[model samples]
Each structure stands twice: as structure tokens, then as C-alpha cells.
Target: MSTYRLFDRRFIRHLAVLVSATVLCFSAAAQNVLRVATEGTYPPWSFKDAQGQLQGWDVDIANAICEKLKMKCEIAAQDWDGIIPGLLAQKYDAIVASMAITEERKKRVDFTNKYKSTISRFVAHKGTSPDVSPGALKGKTIGVQRGSIQAGYLTANYKDSDVKFYDTPQAAELDLVAGRVDYILGNMVTYYVGFMKRPEAKDFEFIGPNLQGGLLGDGNGIAVRKNSPELLAKLNGALAAIMADGTYDRITAKYFPFKLM
Candidate 1:
């Protein structure tokens, strides 16, 4: 071969190798691996099944978002109180635990547009007809999930009532069933699915008006660190895609009879 031709061929081979390596590097970087946090105790939203596997609306939604983004996702079970702190400390890339978009949380972490809207309600024994007004509920013990919007609402509006908080809604429901509380304040969907639908809850019914707005904020959204604008954008895009593609509705139908979005 001519000397010039031999050098040109060798240069082409080197360039091809470098280009392949660069493409592989970019591919690896593009494969986003995200660790998502959730309160595995919240049923219909996120919870553990009989086999100890994580499953629920929130888990399904997170998986769907990952699928839409063509990325790898890991769901990490974290305590509700620590979920936000964990995200702030880089323990998780995002939170999809049905966390409401409240002003207090906005001060700490940025939130994507709400994936689901929610409202709180008061539940009491059937035919009891307990007054729901702040004055009427005075000195009455109310059960609510700690750190939830119901707790905040009760604290802010029902000052005369004694509010007892539990780590999980199940515990508060237990208290209500045991007659330890006059009423249980919680999400309407949760009350309907987790309590009112159960055989044990047949004697109970929802009372008062649906409580929302103000301290409850707008709705439930995925939480991301304030500094992760790119991640936030990606999540928002994925959420929109799922909602538009009917995936969101399918998942909602699996857990709820009524629309939450």
C-alpha cells in the first residue's frame, strides 16, 4: 500500500474507536437511574403487599414515569417524617408518596405539577350525626394521621377539639373503631377505600363537608430537590405523558372507583 493511504486508514480506525467510546459514555450518562422515596405504609397510594413487595397507585405511577422517561427507577420505603429530609440529603432523587404541595414544603423542595387532587373529610359512626363544626366538636377527640393535611386542618381550624395524631391512617382508624375518638379526619379516598369499605367500618359514614384548599395546598405532587431543575423537568414531562396516554387513568382505576385526578 502507498504510505499516504496506510496513514489515512490508520487515522480512520483511531477516529472510529474514539467516536464509539464517546457514544458509549453518553449512552451510560443518559440512562438516568433514580431512587424514589415513598411511605410504603400508605395504601392505595403506596404500600407493601402480602408478599412484602411494594405496590399501589403511587408505585405504579412512579414505574410508569420511569418507563416514559426510559430510565431506571428504584422505590425506597422511607418514614413519612423523613421522606422530605431524605430527599434534601440526597438519599433519594424524588418523592412520589402522595405528598401534598403545601407552602411549607415548597419552602424546602420544589414540586412538580400535582398528579392527583385530594380532599379531607370527617367520618363518624352511622346515625350518630355528630356535629362537625369547630364549636360543636369542642373537647371531642379527633383522630388524624400525623404530618398529614388533616392534622394541619384540625390544628388550624378546630382549636377547641382534641386532635390525636398517629403515624398511619390505619392506627387512627383503629382508634376510631375502638370508640377512642369521636371522629377520624382523613382523605376522602382513604376513608372510603381503607375504612368505609371494610366490614368493620360498615357502621361508620362520612360526615361534614369535604375539606380542601388553604393549608391543604393544591394537590399531591412528586417532590424534588430545589437544585434539580433538570430532574424536575423530566419528571413533569413524564407525568404529562402518562396522563395524556391513558396510563394514569388505568392506574387510577386499579385503586379507586372515582377519579382522583
Candidate 2:
């Protein structure tokens, strides 16, 4: 072959190898990064502070998992209703939004083993206890966050009652304070810490039996898209590691007095 042609061929081969190496590097970097989504309005679990930084138990859990896996993570705030859709749409790689492991949810997405077991209950103005049973709930107005497990439970069981659906938990709380709703059903910790702990909630107290089992779900779990077994396995392993090393408990203590996991 002519020397000119030989030189050109070698140059082309070198360029191809360089391009391939660059692409491989980018893929590896992407694999090392974990993108997480949380409902920023949900306090003590995940919420944005005054400076808009994400904080709370769910945020801590996500950070710990990322640390144990040696993966850098980017957490973004999302609406509670959009969290699952965002994960499936690749807006984020996983959800650490205090979502429960319910059978209905299982059909849409796979979940890491539960990180926290939560109980649901009713909260109302103190001194006026209301029965939460289906029969007692008839003609009452119950406020709940839309697309939450408590919302689903109210829909399924309390058809006789007026269900006030709010896009955010804070909205439902505001209505409860205004006495627009008879009562609100949700996570006990969220009510006590996120809402009722405030001075405005001094008159409100938890009432009715602690709701769990059946439709309430197993517990809160990190959600990832279905068929992501490798990523799922990595997260679950990291979760187990954090719990064993006391990282999980320490984070919990900062936000909650008792163990959630």
C-alpha cells in the first residue's frame, strides 16, 4: 500500500479508539451517579428547608444509601403524585419519598425492602373525639392528601363520607385548622411533627385506632423502576449496611425520637 494511504488508515483507527474510550467513560460515570426524587412538602420524611435544600428522614436515607454504594446522588423535589411517574419517565433513577409498599403500587414499580414502618391514624380538634370506623365516618368530611395510601383507604372504605382531596398535605392541614374538614387521616409522625407540633395545632390531638395492615400497606420503601434488579440489589444492600452500622438510627434520632426502621 502507498505510505499516504497507510498513514490515513492508522489515523482513522486511532480516532475510532479515542471516541470509543470517551463513550465508555461517560457510561461509567453515569452508572456511578444516582438520581433521587422526593416529595418536598412531606416533612420529617423529606422536605425543602428555607434555603430550599432537601432535608429529613427520607433524604437522609437516600444519602446514606448513596454513601454506602459509593455513588454520588442528586435529589430533586417532586410532587407526591408525580414521584412514581417521574421515576418511570427517567426524570430520576429512584424515589425516596416515604412511599409505602402496597400491593397496588407493587404492580407499577419494584421497591427496596422497607426502611420504616409507619402507622396511619386520624387527627381532630382535641376534646371532640370522632370515630374513624366506616359507619361512624358516614356524613363526615375527611381530609387527605391525594394519591396517598390514606387517601386510597378513605376512598375504598368511606364512600358515605365527603373526602376533601388536597394536592399537598399542607393544604389539607390548613383546611383542618379552618374546620372545613371533620378530621384528617395520615402518618402519625407527619401529623405530630410536620403539622400538629406547631403552635397552631395545639388544639388538635390524635384520635381513633392506629390504622395499619390490609390496605395501609407493609411500610415505607425506596421505589425504583421495575426490572431494575441490579440497581435494586445495590440499594437494598446499602440499606442493610446503613442499619447495621448505626447510620440509619442516628439519622432517625435527628428527626424522630423513636426507631422508625
Candidate 3:
């Protein structure tokens, strides 16, 4: 070939190699397995079953969403205390565990449009003089799960009250049953699964208006890395599709008495 023709052919070959590399990079990204982190102790959101298998609303929903995305999903159980930091460190692709979207957390991560709403509920002893009213528990101590919406709510709204933070609802419930705390504060769904379902739960009752919106967050959404714009877009779109098709409502109904999604 002529010298000019040889130069053009080499340029075309180099360009082709560049294009192939780009395509391969894109394909690798598309096929990446999504890692979802959650606090497995939170019932109705994500909790271990009696057999020690991970089962709950968030688990089911995550599987469905992954199915829709046609991507493999790996659910990892992380301590609630470290969930946020772990996500920030890129330990997971998203947190599907009933994590609310809050301004404080938005600084560290992005969230999908809220797919569900949960009210913080208070469980108190039946016929107890002090009920679950926010004001009633002012002097009385209340047990709440640490690093949860219940603890956040109590700290923000009932600063004057004695708020006892426990590591988990199970621990908080023990204190509540032992009369160490007058009441227990947590999400309604968690209360239902962990406490309300127990035979001994008959001694307790849920009370107070559903605390909604604002500092509690617009509701629960999928949490993602702050810079994961493409992943966030894909997840948000998947959520929108599920919500629009009533799949979200169906899943909600299966696990909750009321429509949380």
C-alpha cells in the first residue's frame, strides 16, 4: 500500500480498538452486580427469619427490583450503626432498608424518590396511666432503637423527655417488657413483626398520631452513593415503573396491613 494509505489504515485500526475498549467498559458497568446493604435486624423492613434466612419486605422488594433491572443482587447485612458509613465507603450499591431521605444524610448519599411511608409508633402497656402520647412520655423513659427514625424523632421532638437508646428493637422491647422503660418507640412495621406478633404483645398497645414527613423524611427510599448518578437513575426508573404498575402496592399489601408504598 502507498504510505498515505498505510497511515490511514493504522489510524482506523487504532480508532476501532478505542471504540471496542469503550464498549467493553460500558458492558462491564452494565453487568456489574448491585450490592445492597441493610440492617437485617429491622423487622418488616429487613430481618432474619426463625430459620435465620433473610426475609422481609425490603428483601422481597429488592429481589423484585433486581429482577426488573436484569442485574444480579447481593444483599449484605451490616450493623445499623455502620450502614451509612459503609455506603459512603462504597461497600454497597444501595441500601434498600427502609432508609428515609433526610437532609443530614443527603450530604453523604443520594436517595431514590420515596417508595414508602412509615409512621413512628409508640407501644405502651395496656391500661397504663401514661399512654404513647409524645407529651405523656415527657418525664417517663422510652426505649428506642439506636440510629433509627424513632430515636431521631424522640431526640428532635421530645428533647425534654428521657429517651433511652437501645441497639435494636429486640433489646428495646425487652426493656419495655421489663418496665425499665415506660414505652417503646419505633416504626409501626417493626413493632408489628418483632413485638406486636408475639403472644406477650397483648399486654401492649400502639398509640398516638402517625408522625409523618419532615425530619422523619418524605418516606423510605433506596439509598445510593452520592456520585452514582447513573445507578441512581436506573434505580429511580425501576422504582417508578414498579410503583406505576402496582407491583409496589402489591408487595406492601402482602407484608403490611396498610399501604406503606
Candidate 4:
């Protein structure tokens, strides 16, 4: 072979290798389709609609963030009890299920910056005593969803109260409305939609100050497996962009009664 032809052939092979490596990197990034886990039962954050389709603020936010990052986002339903375990096992890439960013949770998984704020609030019969404080539930049966922030708050604060934990907020709300429980504590937005604003909720009213900055943590955010900073950074970038462009506020206002931005 001619020396010139040999040189040309070597050049072509080098170019092919470089192009292959570049494509591999991009494929790795593009194939970064994030699998997000959510409590299939949390409403206003995530829940099944009348048609059995998953719908809620968290759903909307997930789709929007996926769109921004050009990721093939799959929102999967996992029980709240198993959500953290699922993420740890790589069953899902992240969680955007309105989970509070508590310090204890921080010890387990890395969370992005706060995307939404929530406070634990309680609902009691309309004519319930105004003096009922978080501490006043002592000996009284208070309802909370199992494995939730509200439960943690009650367990921590009202140790004397008989904490009745339910699997879902809807169940707790039902018992509360039926007078089976003294009160129910959960996310204000969920309580508002699932019980407070309902016709039957006319018999119930929200009580006490909004609980936050403590056991409730500093609001809700997306969570990823510990050490997944690359993925976390990507989500943070998309979230920051959306907030800066007012997309987050628009979504929040559409579903929430007040500004959750």
C-alpha cells in the first residue's frame, strides 16, 4: 500500500474510535432515563384519579421536569413503606413524592433543594375545642397515615396520645369524619382536597399552627440514592430553570389554593 493511503487509513480509524467514544458518552447520558417512585396513594402530591390514572401536583411536576431534561421519565407506584428501600436497591432512580427532607432521611438518601413546602396540620370536628394542641392529644386517639411525617411528628410530640396509624390518608380521614379518631394530621393540601373541602368535611375544621422547620423538615424535594450527585444535579438544574421561568409557580397555583412556590 502507498504510504499516503496507509496514513489516510490510520486517520480514518482514529476518527471512528473518537466518534464511537463520543456517542457512548452521549448514549450514557441520554439513556439516563430516570425512574421516579411515588406513594401511589398520596393525593394532591400523587394519587389515582377517577379513571385510575395517576394524577396530582407531583405528577405534573415530574412530567415537566422530565420534559426539561429530555429524559424518559417513568413514574412508578410504590408503597410509601417501601419507597426508600426501592430507591436504595436501584428499583427507582429518584423519588418526587412530596416527601419531607428531614435530617434523618438525609442520613439515608441525598435530596435536592426544596421544591415545595408543606406543614403538618390537623382537622377535627367543627366545634372541637380550640385548646387542643399537638401536646393535648395525650390519651386521645389521634390518626395519622402510617410511615408519614405526620405520624413521626405525633409520635415525637404527643407521646402520650394513642397514635392510630392508617395505611392511607383517605382511611384516616374517614375515621376522623366518623368520629373513630379524635383528629387527623397530614399535608394541608391533601387534607384540603380529600377531606376539608368536601361536603362532609363541613363538620370538620383545621386546627393548630402549621408544623414545620422541625420534625417536618424544610419542605418537600426530590430524593435520589446517596452519591448520585450527577443525577441530583441534573434534576436540580431542571427544577431551578422551571422556578426561574415561573413554570413551577404556575403548576403550584393550578392545583393549590395558595402559593406553594
Q: Which candidate is the best by lDDT?
A: 2
RMSD of each: 6.5, 2.4, 5.0, 5.6
Estimate the TM-score for candidate 1.
0.87
For model 4, give the RMSD to the true fold: 5.6
Please give each candidate's TM-score: 0.87, 0.92, 0.84, 0.87
TM-score of model 3 (CA atoms): 0.84
Model 1 residue 62 CA deviation (Å) reads: 0.1
Runs in model 2 lying further than 4 Å from the true structure: 1-19
Full-model lDDT for every candidate: 0.90, 0.90, 0.83, 0.86
Against the true structure, candidate 3 has what lDDT?
A: 0.83
Q: Candidate 2, clashing residue pairs?
A: none
- What residue runs in model 4 are displaced by over 4 Å at the alpha carbon? 1-30
Estimate candidate 2's alpha-carbon lDDT, on a 0 to 1 scale: 0.90
Model 4 local distance difference test score = 0.86
Error of 1 at 214 (Å): 0.6
Worst 10 residues of 2 by lDDT: 127-136
Over 4 Å off, model 1? 1-31
From the highest TM-score down, the ranking of the candidates is: 2, 1, 4, 3
lDDT, residue 234, model 4: 92
Runs off by more than 4 Å, candidate 3: 1-30, 129-135
Best of the two (1, 2) by TM-score: 2
lDDT of 3 by residue, 1-261 (tens): 799999999999999999999999987985667889878987777888788888888988888889889888899888998999998887888999999887887888899888888777778887766445557667888888888866787888887689999888899998888889888878877787668889878789887667767777778889988788888999988888888898888888887777775
Q: Alpha carbon lDDT of residue 217, candidate 4?
A: 83
